[model samples]
Target: MSRALLIIDVQNDFTEGGALGVDGGAAVAAGVSRLLEAHPDAYDLVVASRDWHDADNDNGGHFAGEQAPDFVATWPEHCVAGTPGAEYHSDLATDAIDIHVQKGQGQPAYSIFEGTTPDGETLSQVLADRGITDIDVVGLATDYCVRASALDAIEHGQHVRVLTDLVAGVADESSASALAELAHAGADVVDSSVVAA
Candidate 1:
């Protein structure tokens, strides 16, 4: 089976010291890079996603303007397109990524499926065209984007594995819940060490 590595939103806005930074986000970025470096051919394709929201407006009410951010639905201004916050974390090696996806352009998007490549191809189309059947997911915010991406991958008929060690979350409880849910949904929630190169 042709396996693909899905890196979800390992951006500066998600890492430590970012707008919506998570505690271990930087570590996840570094760990993912190390994984890619050690297992250069573990997957046939590598795709990375970023939250490229609009800078001019609220991005379809995604950004909290006057109202205080609830942190669930509406969030603070972050990852604006072309901004440094929208850029990928430096620890993540982008040269290994074959497809770069930009999501949440003008709306709320969590799954990588909601994103599109520079040529405007959807994530599903990219995987389908490349005959990708298996996907190993790794990246930031285990409870949010990473969870959504892996769930979408399963729904799209792709076998998915989550590299737990290579992910960081906003909260411990929610992250644990998300992983349990993914495991129940048929995803293999394992550490990266088990993946064969």
Candidate 2:
């Protein structure tokens, strides 16, 4: 099977001391980088997803302003398009990335696959064009974006595997529950080591 690594939302805004900093976000980056180094030939393709929001959009305002009373509402203004927060984390190895998908442009896209390219290409189409059948996902906010992407991958008919060691949740109980939910949805919950094998 042609496998691909889907690195989701490992941006500066999601890391430590950022707007919506998840606990151990930096550690997740380090772990993913190490995994890539250890298994360079295991996966032929690597894709990184980023939250590239527009500063003046509704989704941006909902978070920047106090209008919404959710966990995301309390976050600082981050990941604005072309800004430092929108960029990938420093520790993440970008040289291995074959595709970079930008999400949450005008709307709130929790799933990486939800965003479309300027040419109207969906994330799944991008992978399908590459002949990718198995996808291994790792990244931030397991209960949110990461979970959404994993579910979308499965829906797109790809065998989905979540690299538990290379991911960090939002430091909440829901994160663990989300992982369980994904497993129940037919996703393979494994570590980076297991993925390498």
Candidate 3:
């Protein structure tokens, strides 16, 4: 069986200097790039994901409209489709990614499991098609997308690992909690150094 890497939501909107910027987002992007540079052939498949919310609608009540966002269920306007914020961060080595999955098109999608490729393939389909038995996850907002994606990967019956150094988060406390949850769910919480090809 082959192994795959899931790079989740390293978009400009989630990175530093963009809308809804999270701390260390830019660092995560750069670190992911460096990791790929150091071990380009480590995984058989490398899939990357992003938030591609539609610009017209409020994304199925995901974006708070004229009301204060709770920051849990509702959030500020970010990563709208066709916008620069939706694009991957400049520091990310997009060329190394094999597949691109876009989620939350006019909806609330946190997990990469909720996403599909341009060719309309679901994340699980891609994994199944590629015969992915082990999954390595990394990316932005560790407490949110990364957390959700890791959990879903486990649910999909794949041996999962989250590259601790390769992700950023919106908040520290929640991020720590999310990591604990992932570990409790049987995902290996490791550093990027452990991912050598």
- Models 1 onward score TM values of 0.98, 0.92, 0.98
Against the reference, the lDDT scores of all candidates come to 0.94, 0.85, 0.93
Clashing pairs in 2: none
User: Best by lDDT, which number?
Assistant: 1
Could you give candidate 3's per-residue lDDT for residues 66-138 as a string of tens digits?
9999999999999999899999999999999999999999899999999999999998998888889999999
Model 1: residue 192 alpha-carbon error in angstroms: 0.3
Worst lDDT 10-window in candidate 1 = 188-197
Ranking by lDDT: 1, 3, 2
List, residue by residue over 1-197, the lDDT tens digit for candidate 1: 99999999999999999999999999998999999999997889999999999988898889999999999999999999999999999999998999999999899999999999999999999999999999999997899999999999999999999999998999999999999999999999999997763
Query: What lDDT would candidate 3 get against the real structure?
Result: 0.93
How many residue pairs clash per model? 0, 0, 0
For model 2, the superposed segments whose C-alpha errors exceed 4 Å read: 60-64, 72-76, 117-120
lDDT of 2 by residue, 21-68 (tens): 888999998888988888889887888889888887667444546554
